[model samples]
Structure formats: C-alpha cells, structure tokens
Target: MTAYKSREEVPLNEKWNLEDIYPNLQSWEEDFKKVGNMIDDVKKFDGAIHGANDLYSYLSLGEELGMVYKKLYVYAMLQVDLDTRVTASQALLDRASQLGQKLSAATAFFNPFLLSLEEKTLQSWIEEVQGLKYFEDDLYELYRYKAHVLSKEKEEVLSQMGEAFSAPRNTFGMINNADIKFGDVTNKDGEKVELTRGMYSKLIEDDNRDTRIEAYKAYYKPYVQLQNTIASTLSAAIKNNVLMAKMRNYPTALEKSLFGDMVPKEVYDNLIKATKENIEPMHRYMKLRKDILQLDELRAYDIAVPLVKDVKQEISFDDAYDTMLKSLAPLGEEYVSTLRSFKEKRYFDVRETPGKRSGAYNLGLYGVHPFILLNHQDDLDSLFTLTHECGHGMHSYLSSKHQPQISAGYSIFVAEVASTVNEILLIRYLLKETEDKHMKKHLLNHFIDSFKGTMFTQVMFSEFEKITHEKSEQGEPLNAEVFNTIYEQLFRVFNGDELVFDDEVKFGWSRIPHFYRPFYVYKYATGYASAIHIADKLLEGDSDTLERYLTFLKSGSSDYPLELLKATGVDLTTPEPIQNALSIFSELVNEFAEL
Candidate 1:
C-alpha cells in the first residue's frame, strides 16, 4: 500500500477543484465583503412584509443573500478542512460563521412578520405578485410554522441568542474531540499503537480479539473518568431542547425537532418498535460471529471483527471510481454520465494528508458543483465510502439543478437515502461480479455490518436519546449513574446475552457526539430502511421506478420528506420499510453463516 501523502505531495488532479468556487483568496475576500454588504442591505426590508411588492422584494433579496452566504460559508469551511492547522483558514471560517449568525438575526423578523399576515392575505400576495409566485413553496412552508413562530421581538431574541443556545453542543465538541485522549494500546505485533477516535472503527475490526479489547478499554478510560462532565453537558443539551420545545408549544423536544421536517412522531416510534421486533436477526448474527470465531464468550468488542478471514481486499482509487460508476448503472446512463463527469472534473479531494479532516462528506453549494472530501484508504470500506458520499454528491447535483435556490437543499430526514442507496447498489454489484467465495462472504459481511451500524445501532442510539429526553422532562437528573444505567440496559437489550459488556461500555455514550444533536441519529435508520426498499426496485431494472427515485432526489425541500419518499414508493410513515431492511439483514446473515 502507498504511504499517506501531504497536500503538497498529492497531484493536482487528485485534489478537489476548489478554484471553481473561488479563483483565489482575493476572490474569496471580495465575496466576504459582498456578504457583509448584503447583510446590511437585508435589514432595510425588515418591516417590509406588509405589501405584496415589499414581500416580493424581501423574499427575492433574502434568496440572493442566502445564495451568497452559502457560497461564502462553504468556501471558508472547505478551506479550513483542507488544512485545519492554518490560522488564517480558521479565522476565515470564524468570520464566515459570524456573518451567518448576523444574517440569521437580520432575517428573524421575516418569519414572525409572515406569521402575522393573515393566510388569506399571504395567498392573495402570492397570486398577485409575480416574484412572490416563485417562492410559493417557501411561503407555504413559513405559514406551516405559524403556530410555532413567536412574535417578532421574541423571534429576534431567539435568533440573536442562537450562539449562546448552542453552548452545550460546542462545549461537548471541545471536550470530546479536542480534550479527551484515548491513550494507546499494544497491537498484535507487540508495537504500541496510539488510539484516537478515528482509529476506533478500524481497531474494533482487528482480527485479534486481544487487540480489540485493549483498544476498547483504552479508548473508554478517559470517557469513564469524565463521565460526570459529559453527562452534565448532555443534560444541558437536553434542557436546551426541552426549553425550545416548550417555547414553540410543542409537547416534546422530539416533536419540536421532527416538526420542521414534517416528520410525525409515529415515524420515530415505529422505527424503534420495528427494530425491537426484528432484534432476533441481529442476535442470531451475533451468535454466528461467536461460533465462527470459536470464542468461548463474545464481548462487545468482538462484534466488529469479520467472521470470514483472509478476505481483506485493497482497492485502488482508480478502481474504486470505475466500480462506483459501474455500480450506479441501475440509475441509467444520464446518472452514470453525470457522476463520471464529476470524476473527470476532479470533484473529489481523494487522499488523506497532514492536517486534513478525517471522514468523508459531500459539500454542496447552490451554484457550483459539489465537492467531496475523503481520507481514502485502499480497502473495500473506503471504496464503499466513496460510493456513499458520491451518492450524496449526485443527490446534491440533481437537486441544485432542478430546484430553486430556496428549496434546493434537502432536509436531514431524507439526506441519507441517496447515499445508502448507492452503498446497497455497490454491494450488489460487487457480489454479482466476485466469484471468490471469501470475497463474496466478505461482501455479505459488509452488507450485514452496514445494516448493523446504520439501522440497528442508530436505532439503539435513537432509543437512548428518547429515553434520556423523557427522563429529563420528568425531572430526573441525568448524572453519570443514571446515564450509564440507561445506556447499559439499552446495550444489553440490543445485543442480547450473546455479547459481554465490560464496565467501560457504560461510557460509550460519552464518546458519541451525535447525542449533542438530539434526535438526529434516527434518520440514519429511516434513511437506510428507505434506501433498501428503493435499491431493490431500481435493481429490478424497472424504468418507472428509476425515474421516480430520480424525481424524489430532485424534489429537494419543495415537499415534506415523507411525501417526497412516498412519491419514490418508500413510505416511512409505516414500519414496512424497516421490516424489509431487517429481512434483508437476516437473509445476508443466513448467507454469511452458510459460507
């Protein structure tokens, strides 16, 4: 395998073409100034929502400001991610973030003012004003929250106080990502390997049980020591959620969070219920792992290791690109061609370099092509990750192409669908093409792992969030003891008697940063479930199915996520999709067991 390269060492073609967004730092600064001026320009129309003409002008100006702000923020953040150690880049990102907050505060009056307007009056304006007609969906969406929106003064206060409200999550990031240290563990070769958050996934997957155990313990040590601090931080976050929910007149934080996406609480409840009903498949898979590994007893750390040995396949970047394009062929020539065009245009920052951000994501801007960041390792996992993120890129590409600036960005509720769909397609393609028994088993294991991580594991986290929030609402203190007890019980319930939990397992919640974003993790489960159903239809070579899925991607935030998904023939309101995904998981487990 090739060694890691610095950004300077990586060839130009292998890096993302950020120049497309801004030609140089001078260009970026010019846009930054433009955003500041636009922020001031927007405040002039603060009280202008009374008439049709003012409303049109206000909406038009808001859209323009939004477009410019998104470009500025995306560019700054992307630059920072390229090399976080650069002080200048960090300063640029901070400036952009501050500008964003200023814009938010400036626009706070718009929602409250819109809510003040009578529905009949707003409808009349939409009909009479030509410019307002373009934002019909935007206007309707604003009206949907009329009940939840506060008075103009209150809304402005909330908007201005947004940074303060985010203190818990911000502090959590500092402690979890910056301060906490996981120390080191001895590898199978008897060399000491430093353990970090990024290494946990790969470490847990090591074939050596001893290495996994050591790493798991080492990683959880700091978390356990700081459990009290972490618990307090989480409690504060929950309180923030509860406070916001109460202020919005929503009965619960989950309702308040899901309301924005138009997702009903039943969807969340149905996912947990469905997963609980389908827990047997996961238990069986766990038992299979124990049997295959011939372990006298399975521990939490043992679950991630592969059942099939000697199946580690390293895929090159070029090979991964070609495979991703081929795997997506079910979406037809146009989809494949668009993705291929991205590859040819150097859309991805494809290698890990010093000071570069870890993990993978597709950063989409309104007017420019989507940019993908990847710390690409030469393995099957990296290959699938590339496909998954490219799935997001394609979704963004299509959405931006088809929708207006206001509605182009999709919601978190449906964000993971396209990405997971791409992963499923990639797995299917790999399985069909590979004749090697071990490789096939590896692919099957990969499918099982994906379901476990995205579906079962995320649902488990979802349940934790739900229970904790409910507890907080009930006036139960969320200290370390309470938090640990809750987490331990849920872990045992999900894993069953097949796996053993060390004491360190209690601190696992401390490390999961997703808890900071309450009720956000469950969408991964829903998205995966939806993707499984959609992938099956598209893989069947049905042209209409393919077209509907494409249309769903392009719909963006124009409609509610659930409705858009329904159009794509995946109804998330029901538990059927989750059940279907679980059935697929069971089938894969059975296949892996046979192999």
Candidate 2:
C-alpha cells in the first residue's frame, strides 16, 4: 500500500467524483442560495396550515427543499471529511450545518401540528388531497410520538438549538479526526516515526510481540493523555442525551433512543442478556488465544494477532474489490454488476491521507449515489472492510433506486445487517475456496475475530453505553475516573480473567466515535445476528430468501427495522437470533481448538 502524503497524490480513480453532487463552488453556492430561499418559503407555512390543500402544499414544498438541502450539506460535509484540517472546507460545512439547523427550526412546527390533529381530521385531510397521499404514512407516524412531542413553541426552541446539542460531538470529531496525534514507534527500518491509524492497524497484529506491544502503547498514549478532555466531551454528550430524553418525556435515555426505531427496551435488554448468558464461548476463545500463542500472559494487544501465524495474506485494493465482487456473486448478476460500476464511477474515496477520517463508512445521498469512505490498507482485514462497507453501499444504492426519498433511507437498526451479510459471504467464500489447511485456519480465526468484534464487542459497548447513560440519568458524576472504572470492569467481564489489564485498557472508552450516537452500537450486535441467519440462507441458494433479502434492502425505512428483518426470516424480538449467532460462534471456537 502506498502512503499518500496528500489527497492530490492519491489516484483520481480512487477518490470520489464530487462533481456528481456539484460541479464547482459556483454550483454549490447557487444551491446554497436556493436552499435559503426555500427555507424562507417553507417557514411561511408555519402559522398558515388550516386544511387539506395547505397541508399538501407545505409537505410537498418542505420535502423538495429538504432534498436540495441534503445535497448542499453532503457536498460540503464530504469535502470536510476528505481533509478535515482544511479551514475553507470547515467553513463551508459550517455554513451548510447552520442552514440545516435553520431548516430544522423552520419545519419544527409540522410534527407538533400533525400530532395535535385528531386522527379523524388527519385521515380526512389524506382523503381530501391526492398529493398528500405521498406523505400519508409519515404524517400518521407522528401519532407514535404524540406523548413525546412537546408544545410547538418548545419544539421550535429545541430545533433552533440543534447545533448546541451537537456541539460535543462536533468538538470530539475535531479532536479525534484532526487534533489528536498518536505517539511514535519503531518501524521496520528501526527508526521511530509518529503512528497513524492505518499503521497502528498493521502493527497491532505484527508477528513480533515487542512490535505489537510498542504499537499498542504508542497508539493508546495520546488517548490516555487526553482522557479527561475526552471524558468531558463524552459526559457532556451523555448529559445532553439524557436531557433530551427527559424533555421528550421518555422513561430513560435508552428508551428514548430506541423509540425512533420502534425497538423495545427488551430487544436492547435481550441482546446484552443473551450475549452474557452465552459469553462462556468468548472467555473460552480468550483462553484458546493464550494457549495457541504459548504465552503465560495475554494482554489486550495480544488478542488480535492471528493464532495461525504460518499463513499471511496481503490483498491490494484492486484485488480486494475483485474478490469482493466474486464473493457477492450469490447476490445475483445485477447486484454484482451495479456494485462493480460503483468502483468504475469513482464512488469510493479509497486511500488514507493526512487529516482524513480514520475509519470506513458509506454515506448515501438520496438523489445522488452512495459515497463510501475507506482508509484501506492492503490486507485481509481491509478486504472484509471493503465487503462490509459495500454491503452498506449496496443497501443505500438500492434503497434510493427503489423507494421515494421519504422512505429511501434505512434505519440504523438494520443498517449493519446489510454490511455484515456481505462480510459473512466474503469469509464463507474464502473458506470454501482455499485448499490449504493453514489458509483455512487463518480464515476461521478471522471469522472468530470478526464475530468477537462485531457481536461481542458491540454488546459490551452497548452495556457500557447503557451503564454510563444510566449513571447520568441517576444524577451520578461521570468523569475520567468513573469512565475508566466502568470500562475496565466491563473489559474484565467480557474478556475473562485470562489476560492482565493494561493501564491503557481502562482508557478504552475515550476512543470510540460511536458513543456520540446514543443507543446505536446495539444495532450492530443485532444486525450481526440477523445477518448470520440471512447469509446462511442465501448461501443455501434459496430463491425466495434471496428475493426477500434484496427487497429488504430496497424497502428502506418504509417499515420498522425489526419488521423489515422479520420479512427476511430473522426476528429479533425473541432471543433466538442472538442465541443462534452465539451458537455459531461457539461451534467455530470449538472447531478452531481441535485444529
């Protein structure tokens, strides 16, 4: 993998074609001004809604303006993500953000107004206006939050405070992506150099214990040093969530976060509960790590190294993409071919550069194509990541293609199912294709580690989020010390007593970007379980399963996430899905032990 010193040095084919969104600053500026005018137009309807025609007018205009506004914001936001250190890009994004807040405040009256209407009046309006049919379902969905919705005035006030509510996340984004720097470590040439996230990924799994140790400490040094600062931002974020939950009349922050997805607290509760009841496999795997590595002590750094060290695989971006397409052939020719075109069309920003965001993600702009961001290193793990994100990309692409803008975006609750299904397919493909025993063992280890990361680790994080948010809700003080204690305790419970804790391990809570998004990680755990079932069925070549799964992707937010997954034959309301995933993990662990 080439180390790109700047975004310009990366190949054009490897970067996004932002021109797909906006051709130039002039075009972006025109859209910005147009959105401002549209915001003004929409705001005029605030005190004016009286009947069917008025409601239809407001809804249609508001939706149109929102579509344009999304393009403006995405174009600006994507540039900032490309190189976060750029002040001009930052300014552009700020403008877009403030515009979004204005749009939010402008439309805040709609929800409360809709909820205030009687069910009969709402139904009568839908009967009266043909165009209102486009927005009928969404308008009725407001009834679900009728108890939670505040007075129009208060809702407007809260909407105007959107940026204030998001400040901590924004501050942390700057800190994590653009400000914080990792310490130095000795590289292959025996010279010390400052570590980047890309480099740390490789170094952490180095065959040399000393190298892994050095990289681990150095990678964590900055996070530990800034622990209190990160803690402050995190505390503020959690407090903000709890505050919003209270203002919304929720029983708790967790419940409030789950409300949007229509996911019951039991689904959240059962995920953690089921995982803990089945956690012995995880502990057993940790002990297996110690035995296979022949170490008296296993640290957190020792956990990621491949137990099957005799096999090493290095995959370049091109090969990874080709392999990803091959693995996904089970999805069908159209699915494979469309995903192939996403690469040829430069849908991906594929290399790491200075000041780039550290991880991979797929952002689907409704009217535009899916833009995937990856800091891809040439390795097997990167191959999984490529497949993982393409799963998200395909979901985004299909969702936008099949549904109206209102229903085109899928819920976060089911988002991971798409991505993890892709990963399972890729790993299963590798497992089936490889003839060598060493390679198969490595693949098995990779699969086990992926399970640990996606399911177990996320469940651990879900529990951490739960505990921390509960503490805040209970009026407990949360600082660096409190975070450290909770995190270290969770780590010990999840990983078992086989490994000694590093001081840096306690500071693990400080590094996650996901915690900023409340009650979100649990979806990843749930999605992984749901994907395991769906992927296994697809592998069996069931045409009905394949069609339903594909439709589930295209269906997007047209239905609740659980209902969507249920259509694909994976139900999360019961513990069966989580338990089934755990069973697979246990079987894999035992299979590896015998090897």
Candidate 3:
C-alpha cells in the first residue's frame, strides 16, 4: 500500500536476500569463471568419448556444470527482475546468458552423439558404468527425440545461436518491463502522475466509472502506439518456432512444443475442443456480468472489476499471509510451516518499485530457494495472488528437497496445478469462513473471475497461438493487422456477442508476454481444471488424494508431467477434469445469480 520510490526504499524484509545465492559479486564471478572452465572441459569430451568410462565422465561433468549454470542464471535473473533499469544487473545477466550459450554449444554435441549410439551399446555401457545408472532414465529419454536430433555439427551451430533464438522474448521483456510507459492517470491526491502497471491494476477496477474508463484507455495507450513493433517481434517468435519444429521433423509447431512432455497432439486439440463445446456457461457468465454491473454494454476494462463492489475488505500483507496459511491447513502443517519460512527467510521480492518487472511469478532454482516476485496491493486479489504463487514455491521447495537434482525441476504443465490448487483451496476456505452473505457473494464473484481469467482466457490465448503459428507454417504474412484481426475474432467468439469492441481490444495480443513463449498458455487452463478436481478432493478430506498429491509434487520431472498428474488420480488425457470444472463454473454462476 505504500509507494516505493526505489528498490532501496523497500524494506529489507520485502526485498530478496540475493546474498543467499552468491554472498557477493566476487562469488558470482568465481562461479562464472568456474562454468567457463567446465564448458571448456566439457567440449574436450566431444570426440574423445569412447566407452562407458568416457561416457560417465562426460555426463557427470555436464551435470555438475548444469548445476552451476542454473545458479548463475537464476541469481542474475533475480537481480534484473528486482529492478530492470539497473545496468549493472543487466550486465551481469548478459554475461550469464553468454555463458549459458557457451554451455549449450559445448553440450549440444552430446545429444546428437548420444542418439548415434545403438540402444544395445548404450544399455551395455549403462551396465558397464555404475554412475551412469543415475542418468539412465534421462539418457534413455534422448532416444525419444531420435528423429529430431540433428547432426553434431548442426546441433553445435544451433546451440551457439541460443541468444538469437531468445532475442524476441528478451526484446519484449525489455519493452514490457523497462522501456514502455503507460499514459498519465490522476492519483488520489488529484495530481497527474505517470501511470505504472501497479497503479493501472487498481485504477482499472475503480468504483468511479469515469476513472475506470480513463485508466483503461491510458493503460492501453502505449501498447497501441507500439502495436506494429510488438507485432513484428511476436511474428519473428512464431516463425522461429515453426522453423525449429520443421527442422526437427515435427508435424506441427504445436506438436513440437508438446513432444517434450510426451503429450499427444490430440490432448492439446482436445482441450480446445472440449472447452468450446462447453463454452455456453462462459458466455452466460458474461451476460450475468453485464446484468450485475447494470450496464447496457460491457467493455474490456469492466471484465476485471468485482461485481460485488460494496463488500470490500482491506487485507494487509501480514493478514493476507496469515489467511493464506490458515486456508492451506488442509495440506497439513508441514506444507503450511514450510511456506511460512519462505516469507521469514526473505525469499520473496514483495513490493513493486521503479522498473521492477510487473505481475507475479515463482522461479525455483534447483539448488537454491524459490524466488517469488509479487506486486502486492494489499487487497483480496493480492491475497489470491499470494496463495497462488506460494503453491508454486512450495512445489519448488518440496521437489528440490525430495528429489535429486536431475528430477527436481517440473514442467510447466504440472507446475500450474500446484499453484491453482492452492488458489482454489484459499477461495474455498474464504467462502466457507465468511459470515456475511454480501462478503460470501463477493468471494464467490472473486472465484468466478479468477476462474474466468485462468481457465477461459488462457484457452482463448492458446487458440490464438495455434492460429498464428499455423499462419506462419502456411507461409502467410503475419503483421499488426493480421494479429489484431485474429485476436479480435477470438476475443469475440470466446466472450460471446455481449461485449462491445474497442480498438484497444484487438491489440490484446501485443501486450501478452506469454505469447512470446510459444504454445505455453494452454497449461494454465488444463491445470486449472486439474486443480479444481484435486482441490475438491482435498476439501472432501480424501487423505489418499492428499498423500498422492504431495508425492506428486516431490516427484517433479521424475516422470512425464501427465504421468505425474495421473498418479494423483487426475488424468488430463480424459475430459472429465475439464468438464467437472466447467460444471462448477456453471453452478457458481447459478448460485451467484440466485444471490
């Protein structure tokens, strides 16, 4: 709730203790130098690897280098995200990134060389070396990409271009985080101030209709002004994915993205199909929103405003943390206690300040702790965001603690389930705990809105990604107009005909940073559905589900994401989870209407 003029202005408790990572810049440099030497040492194994001992040596060296690389990259990344405008941190990240490209290039030959060996020979070698048994599963997994693995020479070349491959994403990150500026808005003091993402967040939901309209237009102005530029960046990113998929012999770009998790292309397509088939509830909710707001027409900004405006509660950060902990008691004391320690240990960068990255995320370093970035506004929405990210942090923490370094990290697919499960639990607890009907109704509205944002909107983005990527594969030109047209069309289709269109609405794709990641947003929807199922079971006191779910968290990438999720009795390969979630949404809308 307090304004922070600079990163220094934020309390030490609210800021991250990066010293936990490096202790000092000298240590970071030492690790950077260490990685460089390891990269050189790793390159020596290229042609020299002959038998089991050579293979063991290469794999072990690569694994150690990987641990160091993660620490370096994560430390630099946390620095830049805390304050993007710091050139020193930017330089550190740049050095770390270049170091990563070198590491990638050095090891790129290993994969190609790996697939070159006959399965029988590799198995014999695995039988020959005991250390290799540690890497047996991952080593065998490379065979899954046998057809996709390029020649050693080509792999090396591609790996050298790692920075270039990520250029568009980095460019967009700078634009979104450091360079672009929102238009001015009138603050509570009746002074015109430059609008920030943190300010726009609250202003867009202002009770004053005129203020909301002003904030909405102002918030979108910069994005609209730079639409063509952003369109070009996004177009490049999509084309790059298409090219990578083609080069790797994938049938489609979407399939290429899914291949890592061994998820069937049908799963991706089915998610979209099932959601569209059951989309009437979503459309009905929009109409309900229109009526509840008493508006002749709903607009883009109106979508996020709470329908139950009179039942506002000003929850502070400590209160929000306490509420989140109490709400998560169903997960057992260990989970709740571990989460509380994360706050006490300064693992979170909790305040929004000048040039800090907008939005919230939890990044878990396998060896280090999970660093969560939040722009806390000390309101109900912030409470939900806190619980959501803590889910991810707990997942990261538990997985790292329980699993080996190799399997400690999780895929994006299973990652969302952990976070969304926490969110649903928090909402369920709040809904049951509230004594006032008005407050309960407000909580219900919050749940539905969160559901809409997480499930429906992400599916819409997934489709948008699908369509645009297909356009690139078909050799159609992608530019500002094309992107705007596709986005506006999808927006209308998903939200139904109840809303009026604005110019700012069409440019929505230009503003989403996730679009740069290529075919990644659909997991949010799928995970939301999966979380709904898991959270409901937990609410019913299904101890078996809780134990399996906890084990699922610690399992990490030990198995494919789907297998991990299936182990918890939520099979995303089937339609039941999504349908169950949609049914719940319909029920919530009905209950909300009754209220």
Candidate 1 minimal-lDDT segment of 10 residues: 193-202
Per residue, candidate 2 scores C-alpha lDDT tens digits across 492-513 of: 9899999898889999999999
Off by over 4 Å in 2: none
Q: What is the alpha-carbon lDDT for the whole of candidate 3?
A: 0.91
What 10-residue stretch in candidate 3 is worst by lDDT?
Answer: 305-314
Q: Estimate each model's TM-score.
A: 0.96, 0.99, 0.99
TM-score winner, 1 or 3 = 3
Q: Each candidate's lDDT (Cα)?
A: 0.87, 0.93, 0.91
State, as a TM-score between 0 and 1, how close model 3 is to the true structure: 0.99
Please write out the lDDT profile of model 3 over residues 1-595, one tens digit for every residue: 6888888788889888999888999999999999999999998998899999999998899888999999999999988888888899999999999998888888888888888889999999999999999999999998999999999889989998878989999899888888888868887788999988888888888777788888989888889999888998999999999999999999999999999999988788888888899889889989998998999999988888888877667888889999999999999999999999999999888888887888999999887799999999889989999999999999999999999999999999999999999999999999999899999888888898898899889999999999999999999999999999999999998999998997899999988999999989999999999999999999999999999999998998999999999899988888888888999998998899899
Model 1, 526-552: lDDT tens digits are: 999999999998999978889899998
List the candidate 3 regions with Cα displacement exceeding 4 Å. none
